[model samples]
Target chain A: MTSTHDADGDLAVRTAGLTKRFRSGQVAVDGLDLAVPRGAVYGFLGPNGSGKTTTIRMLLGLAHPTAGRAWLLGSPMPDAAARVLPRVGALVEGPAFHPYLSGRANLARLDAGDATADPRTSRRRADAALDRVGLSAAATKPYRQYSLGMKQRLGLAAALLQPRDLLVLDEPTNGLDPQGTREVRHLVRELADGGATVLVSSHLLAEIEQVCTHVGIMSRGRLLLQGERAALTEREAARLAVTTRAGQADAAAEVLRGLGLADVARDGRALPGGAGTARLTAALGPTPPEKVSAALVHAGVDLVGLEVDRPSLEQVFVELTGEGFDVAR
Target chain B: MSRAEVLDGPGAGLPVAAPAPVAFARLLRSELRLVLGRRRNLVLLAGLALVPVVIGTVLLVTRDSALSGQGPAFLAQVTGNGLFLVVAALFLCLPFLLPLCIGIASGDAVAGEASAGTLRYLLVVPVPRTRLLLVKALAALTFAAAAVLAVAVTGLLVGAAFFGVQDVVLLSGSTVPVGEGVVRVAGIVAYVGLSLTGLVAVGLFFSTLTEVPVGAMAATVVVAVVSTVLDSLPQLSAIHPGLLTHHWFDFAEFLRVQVDWGVVGSGLAVQAAWVAVFGSLAWARFTTADVTS
Candidate 1:
């Protein structure tokens, strides 16, 4: 199995012990070696104050890291910023623009900042981006008058002004309506389909769980778990469920413990046999269930059924971080 | 996945930055849109341009009141030579309004963007920090030029309408043609515009020191006010030559029969020195800033 902390392969963003210590003596990011594979919808999952935004800031060359190095699209940061940032689009923290200008004008101004943007095609690019986010209707309205959802969409439009290799969106769904949130999910999936790697940071697990192919969970400025979404849950230690007659519950529990299981419990579940049945469970370690079943049968305990219950992603995260995630929204 | 995926995609080798001029043009246009498009800036400029008109109109109303020579040095001659109104208007505005206006604009350059949360976006646009600073300096300087010209042109039209055009009497009691008078007025406008560069540099340095636009603006105006006050003290006359406002009225030197290039050149040299010193400090602070906003 690949190590979760390894950043050895074709990574769009690779940081080696990236650390940010503010002048206030606060350590915002601590030794974060974040690895985001190319063409991945990598979710940077963390609660508020988990250093997700700080990490993104460091990656984009906005803030200098105290004691580490980072590379974007295979080039060193701030050094290769002029070269690398052109191929990168970012919406860090939130969308910000000249409040007095119309949405279209703000976008044009931002697009013009790109060195590769053609002056003649600037208007066209800005219009196309606004249209893509379904913001064409209000494109001419002053940005300060835009709704929260509209502002977020405008930020997304600015990021889409150019076809970028990597997009680092910090809380892209912030302040969006449910419909707007769904649209953003679709947009992220579409961008990934078009071969763009997206590093989206969010405090909401559901937001990350639905769209991310890879997840890196962080807590208190430290990354606790990182891996592909499905692989992470599959990699967790699943529990085992065992069923037998109520009268034989104690024997089955003893037999499982004797066979080297942990947290052995005989769940008081009444089977169709009317209180004559028992449901036993335990933390399934390396010991195979087949061996346990045979051992139970030889020990004269009635083993009706036995199987491993796959662990959920929530369980895996909670286990690793020892902190609950806002998984609801 | 690798860099090949991004590089081999459609429009992969799109030049990261256009040729130098083309790229600079884009940065310049966007910055112009921002500085000129802002309502607050427009209001500030209109206010700066209003002073000359107000002065011209007041002088026009009181031309027969015997209050002629009671005001500024050139106010007495404004009725005789309309161009002196432009000179007097600049004299009045220079003491406070001009520095205050440029201080607000220049001070807002970095701190405004920082407070608005746009500084991070601009930096991430990969505008090299040095390049962004250069564009900002240019934009503020452009606004300064516009401010001074606004005062001169408005003062000229009002003065011309109030008093018919004629020869300009030099401080040496000699006379020059009206055409020469207009040219000297233009030269004064240019000189006054150049004079504000030092203040712009000071404002920019203050802007780089904080994320609060109001704080930078206030600090910049304070520096200008302090310089003016310090230049006023007779005991501090030793250091007056080094102050930002000391040579601001040197444009008056043009009212002389023979222009003193020595005085004007030294004034410009002081501006250059200020730009070199504070401009470098601004660059250092900005390039090293964390940009958390």
Candidate 2:
């Protein structure tokens, strides 16, 4: 086990064919293999009930896996859960606390339960945590009286109580308002900047797109893709759309076909305001935009406008997972 | 370089190592706080304490009525020896009130956390599932002991206030010194508490079986009630000694002069067996159950 740890200290999380099946015969998670690099704001993105939370539960040892195994920071799980979990902070699903206890008292109780936490300093740490989350004003308030955003912030505070090597936040901004969402995203960015690997799960592509340095997309309990954000975006195919004179559309299509562009197609809709110009779209492979323009100009085809349309991460995600990305999920 | 080393090298601020595994003692302390802190549990305890007050007041007000000779063997002695009020309250409570309270408390132990969504957080502390279950069981038992004492103390105080403390007469038609009588009352209280340990274990087992606290509580009480029902039927005599509540009243032997150790020993053995069996079941269920909430 230490072999993996020694070979890649930068790998904060690694799983080998991890799987979980409920007794009720529901396969919550299929065989999943994942690796999260250290110091990354890694987004665990998947639709609701797509096994994102289930996988997180398995990673934290909250649920037992039917097959395979996982390692957190190089420590094998369930076996090293006690040692590994203490180094990791997770806010799974959502915030949950004793409704009767004040937020401060809740944190105090949780902190006391950690053997590494100094009881004498728990109060100080709790106060600092509340302050960090901008919840200092409501620190003494009972958790039941808190708003949804406040509860989320309190959960964030609990995760930040002790300095951690990894933070697993499952939809930390689920119920937060716009302002609260911004605050949590900013916090995630800061935590990663401070060198802590953060695995933040969310169904919203835009939410993770703004803060995550790396991403893993899942659908139907299986991981579809995992990599740095830039690499994934770079791998997506860019399309070239050319506006040509109505009579020259077929000519341009034939030129692109002759140039080895097999995916070329005519735009279904006429140009804006029913213009006579025809729009032709082609999948741009290794060919450069300049080369396509020169080819059109050389062919004596009337080229009105040419543009390269890059696919957004959402599009790439949908293409890979074969499902609509519902932010609410 | 390791992530920790990078974070510690410059502006990462105060360096902190990974937290250590939580101690069982700490988990237990937290569990106790949760059990005692709930208003529902507190109200239940207050209600248990009220039982002895009502019994004592009713007995005091009707000292000359037919009620004086109408209840348990201890009831006739209540007016003569105030300590019997403690005995009478335990007698009344053991059958239903005591077990009801224990069931509600223990039943809420695990299921309540699950329903409230706190179980996930607690488990992610990676507080070994077994350890969490153990802490919950220990807290339930603590509540059990406290509940029994509450009823006994209230009975003792109310009885002493109305009838005055004095030497207690044995149920066997013998007399004991006042000091000896005090020791016997303490013994009776301890015995009553020990008798409920099986119920606590059973309640904890039910708690592990559901996420709904009310369901667990009702099932636990129903199980105990059904056992009592089985114990009463003469047709079930062969299984009487095996019933969970069959020897619950064995503490009454403490009121006798000779103290029938044979009966008391068997009662304790039966409770021990129940605890061992049900406690194992609870541990098994809790450690393996899928906490989807």
Name the fnat for model 1. Answer: 0.69
Question: Judged by DockQ, which candidate is best?
Answer: 1
Candidate 1, position A128, lDDT: 93
Runs in model 2 deviating more than 4 A are: A1-7, A239-308, A327-329, B1-22, B64-68
lDDT of 2 by residue, A132-208 (tens): 99999999999999999999999999998988889999999889988888988899988998989999998877876
> What TM-score, computed on C-alpha atoms, does each candidate reach?
0.89, 0.87
How much does candidate 1 score in TM-score?
0.89
Which lDDT tens digits does candidate 2 get at residues B1-293?
A: 35675355322343343333447777788778888878888998999999888988887888887666577657777787788889988988888888889999999999999998888887775567887888898999999999998999998898899888888788777888888998999989998898899999999999999899999999989989999999999999999999999988888788887898999999999999999999999998888777888
Clashing pairs in 1: none
Local distance difference test, candidate 1: 0.86
lDDT of 1 by residue, A1-329 (tens): 12212334478888889998988999988998888888899989888888899999989988999988887866677677887788888999999988888999888888777787777888898899999999999999999999999999999999988878889999999999888889999999999999999999998777657799999988878887787987887786678988888888888889989988999987765665567678899988888778888998999988777878877666777787666775322
| Candidate 1, position B259, lDDT | 96
Clashes of each: 0, 0
